[model samples]
Target chain A: MTAANGNVRLAARSLAPAVLVMGKGGVGKTTVAAALATLEAETHGLAVLVEFGDGESGRRALGPTHKGVEHVVIHAAEAIQRGATPLFGSATMAKLALGNFAMRPLLKAAPAIRELAMLESVRQIVEARPGVRVVVDMPATGHAVAWLRTAKQGREFLGSGPMFELCDRVARELVAPGRASIIVVTLPERLVLEETLELCESIALDPGLEVARIVVNRVPLPLAQECLVDARALAQGGGALAQPAAALVSLLEARAAASAGAVAALEVFAHGPHAIWQVPLAPVDPSARDVARWLRAEGAA
Target chain B: MKDPRVIVCAGGGGVGKTTTSAALSVALAARGYRTLIVTIDPARRLAGAMGVPITDVVTPVPLPAARGRLWALMPDPRRSMGTFLDFLFADEPEAKARMLTNNLYLGLADAAAGVHELVAMNLVARAATEGDFDVVVIDTAPSRHAIDFVTYPARLAALLGGRTVAWLAGLAQRSGGATATAPRGLLSWGTGHVEHLLARVTGPNLVRDTANLFADLALVRERFVALTRRASELLLGERVAYALVAAPTAAARDDVLFLAARLEKLGRRPRAIVLNRADTQAAPWVRALREGHGVAPSITEVLDVLEQERRTRATAADALAVELRSKLSWAAVVRLPYVEASAPEDIVAALSTELDAHLTALLPDAR
Candidate 1:
């Protein structure tokens, strides 16, 4: 890894036309994507924000800070609601009617429709703000793989249509170099790191999309060296009860150390320059205030 | 108990099946029916959508609702499986306890060994048959093997101890039978391996019991087959309506179509389609901004922004509508607008509008 400021930047024109954020759940993919959007919108003065494939986790996370940026959350049901109108009613009443009539049935009827609909939403946002950057807080590894693979499946099954076109475009966007960067977010854990590497392979990460970086979130820093030594020695001379407690502390320290190693291995796997910023685990669930502060700092950075 | 029936929701993963089950149960309750949704997804996401934490046991509490009660339950499969084993092997509690703690059982059970699907299906069938709620909706696991949970018992009945098997056993057991003196066949070798493995793992009594369980499997299979037919009737019955839940993406649509086609093959078509997170335009009066740089500061930026927003809304709207029109013609198509929160009230409200749309669509002739 290079010094923070030495971070390799994607060439604007040559970069992939999109950015893909890959990670396990709760490793702050949404937070980082939101932060990137915050940075783009505030510092760069670009119209930008993150997009989510399903539900509204991303939108909710970015809601308060979505000032200059547009946070577009897409799903099939939402798309249909936007499409319908009152033939003989007010917009409110018409939406109410159509929301139940035209949209709801459509929502329940198809799974591919939801994904295709979301892609369409992404396309819409991109076309709307061509110059604006889009940070997608993409689905978890398994779901994201399914989402990415949909394009190949579509080309085979759906033949040609708007849906197929959108899938092809998204696939091209994903594969195109410098157009997009796949930032794999993870915590320093054997399972998470292993999964990250596996995800890279499953998603065809190597030699295709440049993995921009790996962000290991919520890592607890080790205690002082003396404290760790004391803890380890005490652990060795322990009674049964004391051993568990001492072992726990040792385990935690080992985990923190291993997290760094995991990051190093990722650097080798990526074969590209990356950044590793240590995020301390929150003491409590983040209130909106905490999120706002974090957002502010990220924006400034 | 006005329309006491169950809606067993099943499908592949990442298809929004969980969300659909949650919303539909809420919708039925909103229409004045006491409803419950039982979810078996490992993520326990249904509770997140409902704004509550789920416990293992049944605990019905009133939600902020539309004059009716809706309850949600999420069962931990490991716990459920343990409880079930305790019940099934009541005579062998010590062995059951050991099995629960053993590494092999842990691996096998966690691998789910297809047992999660079996247990989930069994629970749903049992719950539906033994419920007082106006409706019971089941959200199954995402595996394609999920189908086997509902259909396997009958499928394996022949292998289980059927009457034919009983006759064959009786014929084989005949004293001085020619086969008894004959050389061992492939079937005997396979049974010998099965017997040896069963003895090593579960002991002679358990092996016998398991053999008996297989013998009784014919009964279990018959019961499951009957229950499946009953479930189909209950779901497709006029009082109950099956809705296929999907996102509007190509993959999600294809999954739904796959599920719908499967259901059609089973003669159990869904009654409606609930499409979540439909992309709608910002109100016409809302001011929009441009993204890129341009020198002349032309009106093109303003027009371009408006044009983009219009196109975004139009593209999403047209895509799902065309799918619904072409494919799910018999079903009502309800589209839910995206809300920026996972709060239950927010989801319920958004979903309620979609449900209302479905009702309107279903009653189209009324208009």
Candidate 2:
């Protein structure tokens, strides 16, 4: 393994118990979560990859199954059922309450109920399994923020009830240092960079919820400045190669410029406190193993 | 021939659906059709692309060169539910006031995904019917399940119009004034046990507050039903058109197919499948470089890597287009070139120019 790989391995050794990967849609959240889970499992002996929506993303990223890792899809309805059983004092009573047509929709329509149940379910999983590290691939930005804020909203709405207690437990665990950390993934495009900056600012507002890392995915490698100068000279010569050479140079230059701008923006936002990692653009869609390997190489670089 | 009254753009995240929606509206407005583009994305990307601030109010887009006018409505998701409730309870000020301040109602309005989407659509329906516009273009949220929002209004209308809500509201009215007493009736008999179980789990205060909220909502049930019905019709009617936006990645292909299936299940089909950034390869340039000799190795090395990446991306896009064409033969597949601009407005303008050429294919009567 290279020095970068060694550095990534060292960084992977100090992860929190639960890592929530969040970002805008199509920003490689699933890929990062899967790679983190793989790395954590290698060190911890076992890790759980949690998916909130359909389970297809986890399977696609990890290729169905991997050693030392387990994939769990948390559905809100099932989570509500599991969480309410103990509170209702009987499984049958929980089922009856959830099964009623009038009550089911009402509960479903209630704000933060689904989000609270999902978070509570994750808390239960972590408590039930002491040694396994958990990695969650969160949904889009809007829904992810809603899920994070559910605890506070639920507490205010339901002041003193079993649901309130559940919310408090989830909220405490989320804010506990070294218990859960959020990793925000983003791309190097203009709009994506702005959104990433905004997301980091929002995450910073919450006192205890740590922004563990800022990962810039799909960044292109910077080309040598002399190459661009040479290509520009060739373009001015008016040869057949001049046009294609110039096109190639401009494309590369544009991508490199965008990557540089994104990195600079991240640097200003991070201000030497937050960790910023850049993942080079892969030739094709990468799997969990590919990303883990890339992480290692990136760390050494 | 008449233009489609409603145009819905559906796709996965980061595929340029918002840009496409904005461009489409720009193109339509240029053709002398007054258009309003409504975006349900909480990211508020339309404002960036259009270079205008959009709120819940319909704001005019300054398109001085266009033959007709352009407008936009980007409702804040947090406030949409309250705005919708205000509109629903416009006739009864007291009920509206109570419902607005109700804890349960406030909680439901804050983060309910279904309510946010429903209210956004309701706003679209209101704009389409009440505003003076030739066509309404909708930019849906970036998710496979975003299509599900089209069904929410109908489902909610059915739920509220049923006897269950009425009975629950009645129960709340009877319980609020006096001590709880069991009533002997067929509907109440079965629901009484369910209510007891629900109260036990969610707490009695929650049940009472929820029931009271519904009781207030029941005052305008007919108006709610009418609004939802109109929204459903505008979304799912024959005059509505669906445009599926996609990119050239494997994931985008899967997302397009998934969205197509969902639309199909809803008895609808995309009128046009827009392939954004499909033409990324500079083939003539690559061929010329390959034939030329006496080039610097530095330039050659950079060109070689970029050419490979471009070829791979182009090939993937071609393969995706072919597969989608074969699978969804009914929809017209349109390709949009990758714009090299960096600014959001520049990208939107370039895309709008590209879309201007395919208006007829996207909307058959758009000419």
C-alpha DockQ of every model = 0.02, 0.50
Residue-level lDDT tens digits of model 2 in B73-174:
888876777777777888999998898788877665646556666677777766776777788888888889886865665565666666657667656655
On a 0 to 100 scale, what is the lDDT of residue A74 in model 2?
94
CAPRI-style quality class for the chain A–B interface of candidate 2: medium
In angstroms, the error of model 1 at B347 is 2.8
Tell me the TM-score of each prediction against the true structure: 0.47, 0.89
Give the clashing residue pairs of candidate 2, or none. A4-A300
lDDT tens per residue, model 2, A7-69? 765665455778889899988888888987887776566889999867887888887567898
Steric clashes per prediction: 67, 1
| Predicted model with the maximum TM-score | 2
Best by lDDT: 2
* iRMSD of all candidate structures: 25.6, 2.8
Find the candidate with the highest DockQ and give its number. Answer: 2
Q: Rate the local accuracy (lDDT) of all candidates.
A: 0.51, 0.76
